[model samples]
Target: MIPASDQDLEQVQAQFQALVMPHLDRLLGFASRRTRSVAEAEDAVQEACVRAWLGFAGLRDPAKVRPWLYCILRAVLADNCERDGRRQRLVSITRLEDEHEALVGGDDDAVLVEVEGRLTGEVIRAALADIPEDFATAVEMHDIDGFKYQEIADILGIPIGTVMSRISRGRRLLAGAVASNQRAWLRDDGKGERQAEARRAARAGGFDGGVTS
Candidate 1:
């Protein structure tokens, strides 16, 4: 294929930045939650953005920017997994059942109320980390990143029903993880107090709903 002129490349870069740059933090958060290491997440984001930039001239709709970038990121993640031989360890959807079922009992909506009341960015990250990767991906894309179900389905390359199921199951898992006092991750000395302060600050900064668990 013939390369675009420098002027065309410049316009593509400008448009790509305008649309994609705004979502970079969220995308990084997405990658960070999925990957085991910070370096891996950063590498995934870098590769995905490079691929995005290379294909920017073909992107026709500004509104589709977020999903397009996510699609690229997912591909990068899959590639990374394959390269690292982690793909063989991927558990099927059926394996999520036990964890899904563990989310039962105890006043979920009440737990959700407590979670929302004291939600901080750190707490959200922790909760996301506690869930299955697939479920967390769906939840973060739909709830945290504010993508529609259809967009999430497109980005995840799954049926819309599957996306909805994942979001529902993922939200339950997040709520359980956040509300449980027995969680080992929440046991750090005085960390809960710090997280509470962060929550208040987040509210003051207009993060009202706070992850919609």
Candidate 2:
């Protein structure tokens, strides 16, 4: 808390407004993508703001304020999950942290272009929702939000290596999801076409009155 002196209180408020207020919209966008509903996102961001204000005085570096705010927001979400008994899925044994660097991510650009070609914004969002939250957050922050590895690490409080792995794996998972969608769409489209063709044939007297095969 700011000192009891009115002058100190005013100074803290001014400092917070200057350093933090500009990012509110961006923060809300981030929270919205991470949450299930807009209402949840709004409540989370609002709570994050309140917590940020309360802890504003302890912040030493103004330059890192954006990631600091994100870290706080993540913590708020985690706490909510814990309170609600949401189980956090952790890394499987097959994906040890050491192997993250070894993932075949050299064609990252090529893969991204392909994925973009196959998916629309709505489809991309759906794909993101289909993956694990941990991987999705890392990928979204890096590809969509344009945060660097170190910045993501700082915000997530995880190692840079782990962040890299999650993104690599996340991209692969997202591509798979997109492909699955395409297949499903093709199947549905084909079924509709077949149904329409059958109707056309019946109308043309191809089925006859008995409709024998």
Model 2 pairs whose backbones collide: none
lDDT of each: 0.68, 0.66
Q: Predict model 1's lDDT versus the native.
A: 0.68
What TM-scores do the predictions have? 0.71, 0.67
For candidate 2, give the lDDT.
0.66
Please give, for residues 1-213, the per-residue lDDT of candidate 1 as tens digits: 545787777786787788988988888887765666567689899999999988887788888888899899989978876676552222223333444444444456564455466556767766554455678788888888889999988888889999999999887676665655324334557565455444433322334332232
For all the candidates, what are their Cα RMSDs to the real structure? Answer: 9.3, 14.0
**lDDT by residue (tens digit), candidate 2, 23-92:** 8877887776555557888999999999999898778899989889989998987787667655433323
Checking candidate 1 for backbone clashes, the offending pairs are: none
For candidate 2, give the lDDT of residue 72: 91
Error at 79, model 1, angstroms: 0.7
